[model samples]
Target: MSGIIQLDNSDCSYIKANVSNSHNDAVAFEMKFAKDITIAQLKSKLEILTGGSASTMKVELYKGDTFVTALSNNDAKLGFYVNCDGLRLHVIDTFASFGFDSESVEKFELTNDQYEQRGDSVRNFLKQNRLGKYNDEEMQQMEAKRREHAEQMQKRAESCVLGARCQVTVAGNPTRRGTIMYNGPLEGKTGIFIGVQYDEPLGKNNGSVGGKSYFVCPPNYGGFVSPLSVEVGDFPPENFDLDDEL
Candidate 1:
């Protein structure tokens, strides 16, 4: 699926090139990789898709694709947004929209030894699996499982509510007030699963003095969420388009 971008204030005439229904002043999907992709080829990739030269274009960080920030105007990644959006990118220099998670980039700096060893291990694993080596039914099951696992990982990375204003005292009325949970169910309080853990899967709270476990949320500000909401990645039967009817 093309990545969903929500346009903010900038006029989007350039969208006509890479997107259909460009005249629609609403949310649209901008395909991220519909063209040939190569090693360290970010600029050509953008130019090819947006019909513009990446070097001369301005950039911005957009939520979905719009909702430009009021801060972070100097970042270079903004070019990515402009190139993908096919227009002069506007720089955002403020807090991201109230209801959106700020876009993030985490770069892992690995030692040369680590990189080489990891690459070799990956290569060996792929070679072991090879291609065209499984039966049709087995392939279907495997694909479904892979998709499920991916979905789980994505969900885990995203938390629906970053900070919930809750008051807890652990029966002793701790000195501080106002609460926000980073990773799990709080005692006597249910958590909204931005993602979930599995059956009896223990959770490590990001907060200090963490010692609480909730069963579920009851659909209220403080309701307990379902146990199934927090789950470890699992291999499940894939439901493709044909299976939608079921």
Candidate 2:
């Protein structure tokens, strides 16, 4: 007796297809689909992988870069389009050309303080793993460096005397002439901050910050800066008239 069985063409159940899309043409993926599956069903499955909506997607059949027929009828079976192994199933997302994708959707984000409070955050993971700043040796080194910087800044602040004429020379800013109004530590902040009363109205505050008054000065003519950027000099105030400018 012969032990071999014969199968007909009707036994073929699935077709392997190379899938791609218009938005991303650099890569193609091979996927298998049942021959009896309808076009709408196939589109619903493709939507998860392509990030395109099934309702607005247009599927086209291809044979190794050669153009074939489009699977336009959603109710028709995939096998009706003469689907075979190694054929390409290209998807065209109608709204993709108009910048529609997952990136276009608004996303929720957490602030620094909010993220720090979450136990499942990446910062908490690093802290538990004892990596980066959580390491004992690194923490000690960071503290030493911070103290060294504080001492250097304190030494620089000793040169900035109150009521002395000085010039502020911060990087990427025009040289400004001012008088040293206050020279000490600011409230609720580290390091020495130099309070200056600028000759012109080109400052961010009126000799106050966080509702605390450090000195007396007109509005928009007081600024607080680092002592390193201040130079005690014989700088005189320059006079200007608004009508002289073009």
Candidate 3:
């Protein structure tokens, strides 16, 4: 019975599925599948809802401790075992039961509101299971990293003297060569800044960032960068020549 079934209708059959993970955490949800879908296709859909691999998931039709035949073949059609509508399919995830990999299974491309709703469910589950220790440890580590970054920024700000030759390396952007025109906080800004007058016109504004000017320069020839990203160095401009002095 591990082949396609010729059903009378082409419409998808919506059925309630009881998906249980390795830890016995169960979630009931409605799933739609074409009547002639193979066992492999049904297993794939259950994997999305339960994190169960198609190779390891066990499918069964049961009712109140009643023993029923398990769906063992991945090539069989749904209509082979699912005789009528509203049939309950219990999907057991063997991969999760052994506690080997416990990564969260979530859908991607979710909106902010959808993420917030899912986050609430996760928070409730964590609270009920007392699984907040791992999250707390991760937060502490992140806070430590923030403090380390602040200390580095303070050192860079103190070392950045006006007219100092510097190179700014913004993440994912090309390195920029410039001179430190100013080295202090701008008006209406929270953190210290390094106003760089670039050797080329690869800047956003004339020594300004976000509409606040810290120093004057030609338009599109200067920009403000974070002191943390500014590398104060003895390296002069690439075109600077000792032969000119000679």
Identify the candidate with maximal TM-score: 3
- Weakest 10 consecutive residues of candidate 1 by summed lDDT: 168-177
- Point out where model 3 deviates above 4 Å: 1-122, 128-134, 187-190, 240-246
Q: What C-alpha lDDT do the candidate models reach, one value each? A: 0.32, 0.74, 0.64
As for lDDT, the candidate ahead, 1 or 2, is 2
Once fitted onto the true fold, the runs of candidate 2 whose alpha carbons sit more than 4 angstroms away are: 1-130, 134-141, 238-246
Worst 10 residues of 3 by lDDT: 1-10
- Give the Cα-based TM-score of candidate 2 against the true structure: 0.42
Q: Which ten residues in a row have the lowest lDDT in candidate 2?
A: 1-10
Over 1-246, each residue of candidate 1 has an lDDT whose tens digit, in order, gives 012222222443233112212212221223333222221244445445444444543333343334333212333232223322332223112322355554564544655567447745433343345422123454465456546644653564353343433322121122122223344433432222332221121222222222433433222223222222323233232334765675
Candidate 1 structure lDDT: 0.32
> For each candidate, how many residue pairs have backbone atoms clashing (under 3 Å)?
25, 0, 1
Please report the candidate that would top lDDT against the real structure: 2
